[model samples]
Target: MPILQWLTRDEDTRAVRSVPYRLLQEESALSCGDPDAANMLIHGDNLDALKALLPFYAGRVKCIYIDPPYNTRSAFEHYDDNLEHSKWLAMMWPRLELLRDLLAEDGSIWVSIDDNEVHYLKVIMDEVFGRKNFTSTIVWQKRIGPDSRAILGAAHDYIVVYSKNLEAFKATANKIPLREDQIAEFQNPDNDPRGPWTSSSNFSAQGFRKNQMYKIVTPGGAEYYPPEGRCWVTIESEYFRLLKEGRMWFGRDGRGMPRKKTYLKEREGQATWSWWSNSEVGHTQESKKEIIALFGASNTFDTPKPERLIQRILHIATNPGELVLDSFLGSGTTAAVAHKMGRHYIGIEMGDHAVTHCAPRLQKVIEGEQGGISKSVNWQGGGGFRFYRLGPPVFDEDGHVREDIRFPTLAAHVWFSETNAPWKGKGKSPFLGHHDGKGYALLYNGILGDRRPDGGNVLTRSTLQIIREAAAKKAPTFDGPLTIYGEQSRLGPTTLARENITFKQTPYDVRARR
Candidate 1:
């Protein structure tokens, strides 16, 4: 496999490791509607924000769509759309790595780009996400008309898609819904009792098979044989079975070649193709108009994606109530679409427009403002989202856990460090959760209802009993090797070994894992 190399390739590849995990500090005042909604809108650099989310959302997102700066070598009001080629690659490398870690095994990611750096982006994406997982590139016609000033009008942008695991993604992949024109193709020509249907001319396949070369006599008593270098789609016995079931068509006159009748009621959906026209999804001008409506034309977002484009992505890549993520949230089109379509989402944006553009747009969405795809999806919205900003890092300069870290925050980190998976702990007990046959407990910040020296932070005989009692309440039958993190342990090494217990001192063991 070929790898894309740049001046800072080595450092860029290792950048994710150097990114410190920060805390997501929620702004309650900025939040809207339901306070407990899983939807989040964060204001921070996406690299730090993604790293911060790993402890709680690793391998949980069903779909991720990112529209980063295109590096188009042109000035934009919102983003620095120009960058040195290698610097742009350097910036994207670590972010992609973190996004890959955040994606579920059966999940997929879609990235929007243009001719500026799409080929380079593809090469790096092929490296980060395995080349084998590369799905088709969708050529979205972003422009409805030709560019009068350019020699060759660039009318399309590429959406590069990749799945975490190709086979797993395919098992849950959805099909595109049939358009009105496609549905119009089906008609009840003969008034069949079953339903409206269209005839398929592929009754004969392009292959020579001995069993599939039998004759077929239509209802009109006209016999037909397989054409030259072709064979019937099925053997004689199967053909007769279908004919008895009225699944074959012989044209209105009943003397034409045999065809297969596919009923409209039986069709699931249309298979998605690589090309997408502006009529199917929307054009850049349409997207610009949507932004203008949301935030007045004076404060329009420069590179906002059409809500229908994101709608089409969510329709194919996810089901209702599934989780979606967009690190480069831009004008929050992905979040708005995901919300209207009933999917949980986390959108992260770096600029102040996260407060101005994205949040305001979503607020209108909650109010059921019928713009963009709102009318199409019947979006009478009644959900909410929390607003957050990147806070202090979990660890300090000397590599010790921050004193201000709360139990829930440290618990998430502890669980993730112990299991290499996202933490699902509810922060109600000292026992975080069980994973891979090992039970984990954290005795920090008075989790055991006592903050004395030997009360909760230290693992004494009494505190150990309380921990066991809490663990039993959660998982009564979970009697396995116990890994507990506390300040100190009173039990001797021999006693700890005999009890199948591993005691790790906090701030030391946790930092070591990092």
Candidate 2:
């Protein structure tokens, strides 16, 4: 496979490892509506914020949508859209890696870009999320009208999509609801009792199969056979079965070519396609108008996506109560749409607009403001989101755990580092959890009521016995190798081996740094 290279390619690709995981410090004052809602809006650089989220949200997000700076070499009021070619690539590589880590195995990501860097973006995404995972590049008509002044009027943008696993995504992906025009295609010409039905004209397929070239006699006693280069869609027996069930259709004169009558009641919906017209989803002009209505004309966001566009994505990519994430949250269109659509979301933005624009807009959404897709989804609103800022790193410059780090925070990191999975255990016990035939335990910050070097924080015979009891109480069925994190182990190497225990020192084997 080919790779995109630049001056800082090596360093940029490895940049995610160097990013110290920081804490998400929630601002209770900035939160609104239901305090316990799972929605979150974070104010921080996306790279660091994504790293911070791994311990809690990795492999959990069902859908991710990001609209990064297009690097169009033009100035914008909100985003720094201008950047050197290599710099743009460098900026994106590590973030893509982090986003890949955050995605569930059956999940997918949608990225919005333009001609400025879309080709390069596709190459890197193929590298990060495997090429086989590449789904489609949807041509979204972002502009309703053409830019008449340009040599070639640009009216579209590309939405590059990729799934974590193609087969898994296909198994669970939703279909797009049929539009009015599409539904109009199904009509009851004969007033069949089944419902509105549509006819499939191509009864003969492009293949030469002797078994499928049988003759078919219409109700008018006119016979038909497969064309020169084709065969009937089904064998004679299946065709006779369908004809007996009244599933065959002919023209009003009863002497036209035979067709299949498919009833509307049997159709789930329409499958998604590559081209998305402005009339189907929405256009940029509609997006700007939405932002203007929410924030007013004077303070409208520069490049907000229309709520209906995000709504379309969420509808196909996720179900209700699934997790959605957007690191380049921009004007919070993804969050608002996900909220109204009943999917939990985490929106990260580095700019102050996170507090100013994103939060306020979501507040309106929670308040039942009937803007954007609120009426379309029948959003009466009542949910809420917590606001957070990037806090101190989990580890300081010296690679030591921060003083403010508590048991729950360190435990989450320890579990994630050990198993590469989210921590679902409560911090009340030293036993973290078990994964893949290994039991993990963490003794930190007085979780066992004693923090002394020789007490609960150390792996002594007594502490080992306590941990064993807790593990047995939790799992009960079987025994496994135990990997425990503590300050020190008083047991000898022979005893440790006999007990099937591997003890790692705290703050050293914690994996807070690369």
Candidate 3:
């Protein structure tokens, strides 16, 4: 595989690992509608938010759509869109690595970008996601009128798509729904019982084939052969079979070259094309109007994406109830679309607009605002999302576990560090659940609340008795070694080794990573 190197490539490549895991602090007051919703809108640096999400959402997201800054060198009120080439690569490298980890095996990622850094973005994406998984680059007509600034006006942008595993995506990738114009093309001219149908050219552009160059005699006794340089699409036997089945069509006079009738009943959907027109999806002006309508003209974000564009993406890439994440939650179009389409979503943003623009608009969505894509998706809208902020880093800048870290938070971190699995059990005493034949236990924040020297957070004869009782109830026949993390332990190394136990002292073992 090839790699794109920049000024800070080596440093930025390993940046995600060095990033400290931070707990997501939910703000009940900031969240709207329901408190137990699956969707989330996080306010913080997106890189930190993505890192925070990994312990819970790794390998679980069904789709991810991000519209990062285009590096167009223009200033916007909400963000700095301009960066030097190496700095831009430095910024994008780590986020891509984390996003790749969050995708399910059959999932895909779509990124919207313009010409300024698209070539570089492709090279880096090829490096991050394997080149074998690269899907086609869709050309979106974003504008209608030409700009007079340059010799040739720019009117389009690119959407580079890649699948986590191309083979898996191929098995379940969806077809596009037929547009009104496309449905109108199917007409029941013959009034056949098979329903409305459309006529398509039946000749192949390929050269002569053995059985494809056949002769057909029409009802008027006119002999027709394949055109001057074309051949029949199939062998004569199949053509005659379809003709007998009434799937073949001739002109009203029944003397023209034969064509094939494709019935609407036989179509599941239309295959998506690489070129997307503005009339089909949407354009920049429409997207801005939607923002103005939602925010009431005073609080518009820069370069908001059209909801129709995201709706199209969701229709093709995901199903209802699947998880979708947008780390760069600029104007929150992705989350709104995902919500309206009945898929769960997580949106992360650094700017304060996450509260002002993203959260407020979502509240309107829950109240049944019939704006962008609402009518199309039939969104009567009663679902909700939780709002979160990135808390202080779990390990502080000096690499020490913070004194304020709670038991559940520490247990989550420990389970992730030990097994790299999501913790599903209630954070309780004696047992933290088992994975890969090893049982984990955390005794932090004085789980038993004795506060004495031989408390629950300490490993003693009493603590061992509690552990044994809990394990017998949780895993009765388990004989695997128990890895216990605690504040202190009174058991000797000889006794600990004999009992098939390994005790790691907390705050000491945890802080060593820093």
Q: How high is the CA lDDT of each candidate model?
A: 0.90, 0.90, 0.86
After superposition, which runs of candidate 3 have C-alpha atoms over 4 Å from their true positions? 203-246, 250-260, 396-403, 424-443, 446-482, 487-503, 510-514
- Measured by TM-score, the strongest candidate is 1
Where in model 1 is the C-alpha error above 4 Å?
512-514
For residues 24-55, what per-residue lDDT tens digits would candidate 2 score against the true structure? Answer: 99999889999788999999999999999999
lDDT of 1 by residue, 225-270 (tens): 9999999989989999888898889988888899999999998998
Q: What is the C-alpha RMSD of each candidate to the true structure, in Å?
A: 1.2, 1.7, 3.6
- Please report the TM-score between candidate 2 and the true structure: 0.96
Tell me the TM-score of model 1: 0.98
- TM for candidate 3 is 0.87
Clashes of 2: 0
